[model samples]
Target: MGNEKDSLRAKLSPMSYHVTQENGTEPPFRNEYWDEERDGIYVDVISGKPLFSSLDKYDAGCGWPSFTKPIELEEIEELEDRSHLMVRTEVRSKKGEAHLGHVFNDGPKEAGGLRYCINSAALKFVSIEELEKEGYGQYKKLFS
Candidate 1:
């Protein structure tokens, strides 16, 4: 556990370590991807596993990067969260188990009505143009 923490600390920035490992939240609107308007795929920062695609991203007015859903349902695990004095469903990467953020029922009604509010610190975006070079060519289909 110590070795993993050490490795993670070395790989991730302080804010990323706090958000992904410590379950800390970054300030809204000031976050990296909160206002990102690019075409790409969002992968787990630690494990590099595909999580969300820019095709599903939308401005939910929550100051965080919001997605209608993951690239694949199997890529994430939603758990009941009782922290912060409010019951919510927590989103985490299946492989990395990084704390992504929460999912709420207040998303666009036409988009399945689920808001996956994610932390930018937990993800690394691979632009559509750089997908192949980033070894994420498979996700290019989302852009097409």
Candidate 2:
């Protein structure tokens, strides 16, 4: 983990470092991807592991990017967070262990009744056009 942190420190921006490494949250509407409507996949910034897809994204009026579900359940790790005197589920990337964000129960029920309120700093977006070249060719079918 130390080596990974060292490498990530050199690659990530200050805001990314704070969000992903220090478990900090970016301001809701001011962050990236909150209103992104493009077709793509969101991956962990550090590990480049797929986390969410555009197909699962929706507007939750929370000022942050929200996904109904992840691309793969195994790609994320959910832990019980009791910070700020509140109980919440903290979502982290399984491989990178980056602090993605929290999950809430107040999502559209038809979509699964769960909202993965993720931080954009913890993720990198890969548009449909770049899926193949980015070694995510297998996921291209999802877009099709």
Tens-digit lDDT string for candidate 2 (38-136): 999999999999999999999999998999999999989999999999999999999987899999999889998999999999999999999999998
Mark the 10 consecutive residues where model 1 has the least summed lDDT.
Answer: 135-144
Candidate 2 lDDT trough over 10 residues, lowest sum:
1-10
What TM-scores do the predictions have?
Answer: 0.98, 0.96
Question: Number of the top candidate by TM-score?
Answer: 1
Clashing pairs in 1: none
Error of 2 at 68 (Å): 0.2
lDDT (Cα, tens digit) per residue for candidate 1, span 1-144: 999999999999999999999999999999899999989999999999999999999999999999998998998999999998999999999999899999999999999999999999999988988999999998887777
lDDT score, candidate 1, position 98:
92
lDDT (Cα atoms) of all candidates against the true structure = 0.94, 0.93
Return the number of clashes found in candidate 2. Answer: 0
* Model 2 / residue 115 / CA error / Å: 0.1
